[model samples]
Target: MKDGEGHISIYIELMDTSSLPTGWTVTALVNLFVFDQIRDKYYTVPAQYSFTTDYSLVRFSAVKLEWGITSFVELEVFNDSSNGYLVGDDCVFGADVFLIKQPINKVNVLWMKLYPKGNGKVAGNNISAYLCLDNLTLPSDTNIFVKFSIGVRNVVKSTIIKSTSTGKHHFDYLSPSVGRLHIYPNGNKMKDGEGHISIYIELMDTSSLPIGWTVTALVNLFVFDQIRGKYFTVPDYSAVRFSAVNLEWGITRFVELKVFNDSSNGYLVGDECVFGAEVFIIKQPINKVNVLSLSGEGANHLTRTHIWKIRSFSSLSLDFYESVKFTCGDFKWWIKLYPKGNGEGKGNSISAFLHLDECNLPSDTKVFVKFSIGVQNVVRSDIINSRAEHHFEDLSLGRGFRKLISLNKFEDLKNEILVDDVCIIQADVSIVGIVTTK
Candidate 1:
């Protein structure tokens, strides 16, 4: 049949309905098709419908035995020569019917949660809801399209407090996690003043966790130095506890904005910077105490200075050179220098490290020291130095700065760091404290 709007429809009509049983009804899956001349295929439209007698038509001595699509195809499309529906004034139309005694059923499951106290930035002021898909039950590469609605009812008012329908969303393996890093380039006013950047690691929906649950972890934040290819690490000396009341922990003044934005610093290059975090959860912390005794005030606390002079410094070609062992505190130490820098600072700066000789000390002993290492400019009496405090043990034998001094400044004739092919490096060591577990 053809409609007034120039659309043709197909219908299935049962003949001789008088032979059917009383109050008869049948359901069928139907497909209407048109022949494609060029492709030699059929363009089919499939649908399901139940056919029953129409009592109104029965009163007029007729039976309503027709049920099918009302808009199968437009007349213009069916007659178009390019569509291959009609070729040389000849076309074919047909239908296929699959009778079904019972309909098949399928079920899809999804998990959802509602937070009356809100979550994330909207916590304590608004309500939020989230839907989760069960990935464990599905194939690894499966993708799901979802549309859902969430509503909260006000029982006292007999009305909906809020109702919202989020249209369609695609879910995949790369979905966002509940923990995120919050960075404020201009600094967080509540935590820090201006001229600095603030960073925090936050657990988004802490209210969803089990009661009295707490997580203790050692967190370290880092800013990448693009030019040096290394990270400036800011480590937390102690473990931080995260709970429902306390959702985040971080540095209020991570880095001064001026220092981070400076091009020479290699931090904010090309208007981009990288920030990351390392969180090590302490699953079973040991219950132990450490007592430290420093040796820098009394007779035994005298500072020790070691000056190592290298002849033919310009002729040294090794990647690294180590000074002879020197006495510091109760342990022996040495100075390790990379003439052309090392690791991330290779070819750009001079790298120096203080190494502890752990062979003589007890296997479990840890030594804490504060030391300064420098290259002396003999002509101007100006020293380029780097100072740090570190704990040295069997596992951690060395620690120092990679970019100690730029090669340009270190080798400049005016700096006189290297004079007449001779260079001198000095180290000042002091025993800060020692950590020994009982």
Candidate 2:
């Protein structure tokens, strides 16, 4: 059969399992195959299982008598011409089963311990638990991938106290343990000691990492405003270094308690709030140092201007248009215009934006730019304009006004901003500084 993800499935079906003996059982190693015409060979997937009448194996039963591979081969690989699994619109599939004698039963048990009073770094503040495996029962080199769940039960009410599951993890000779720690008594710790909101990013299990490992990253934290439908973001302009000794970085007082709790602010609604973070890891070259050069702020600053002339402006029906790329401050930039405006200005005004070509900039590079976007008046010296300054990086590649000018004012006959169905857009860009890792 074919599965939903376009993969072939194979199953072993048993007939009349109720007529078998009480302890009847058969163990076998099975292999499913797909014939490759080009190679004149078979692609095989192997698995081992035991079909039994006994109740020990929970997965096998009289009612459920079939078991096998669900993903035998991908449809794409089976149908590709070059691979030749299918030729002349015909394909071959088969299975092989080898009977095996019953093997000795072995049981591996995992031990878990809970500290009701908490432990280690979380003492007195939270509860903790650890999972342990008896390495002496297995070979020294043996490794197992395991996933399990832990829960605290309420004995009096016969209900759940708290429960969490550990995602898959590898257990080996060196690192044979994995567990959870510092589960707060009440709930998640969204607030700091001062009653204000707090947030941070921490590297998990840093003790297991190799020595001398370090990571440098730029971090941005955000809180969602339910009323505004936008994020209130705080960003770190510079990168923060994280190592074994310093595993976390963030803001303790992300927002004042009074401000965030206010109903009008829309930060917390229905006793729920959303918080998120963006961390960009900066990779550095081994055995080399990075030097950042900054351009002077005042007299030594560099500036440039570009004018875009849009002919047949009324004929533009698209949502937005991009001007030809121009160079400034050793970087490429382009002007973006929305004929019918966008976002808040849609259908009522004209929108304009300046964007940096982030693809050409290094991952660790950031450019601080001050710029002005305007529409030139053909009949008068006055130009409708707006100015802003921003630090351009991967996350923020563009900045501009959503309502550059009201459509009524821009189209007024006396303004002459648009004459002969041609309009002019101008941008004055100045580079304040630049930071880059060499």
Candidate 2 positional error at 67, Å: 38
Question: If candidate 1 were superposed on the true structure by all CA atoms, what would the RMSD be?
Answer: 32.4
Candidate 2 residues lying further than 4 Å off, grouped into runs, are 1-301, 413-415
Judge candidate 2 against the unseen true structure and give its global Cα lDDT, from 0 to 1.
0.65
lDDT of 1 by residue, 37-138 (tens): 556588865321101111011111134567656687889998889998875455668776544332222224567766789776867997877665554554
Please report the TM-score between candidate 2 and the true structure. 0.36
TM-score of each: 0.35, 0.36
**For model 2, how does the per-residue alpha-carbon lDDT over 1-438 read when each residue is reduced to its tens digit?**
345378877677666777777766654434567777556578865222111111011134455667666777787877787887775354667665544332232335567767788765667986776665665664544545565556678899898654332233334433345523222222235543365666555544445557988755444556778899987755332245667777666666667778887878987788766665544343334544344444555434368789999999879989999999998867899999998998878899899999999877887778878899999998886678999877788867888888899888877843387778788999999887777654
Task: Extract clashing residue pairs from model 1.
Answer: none
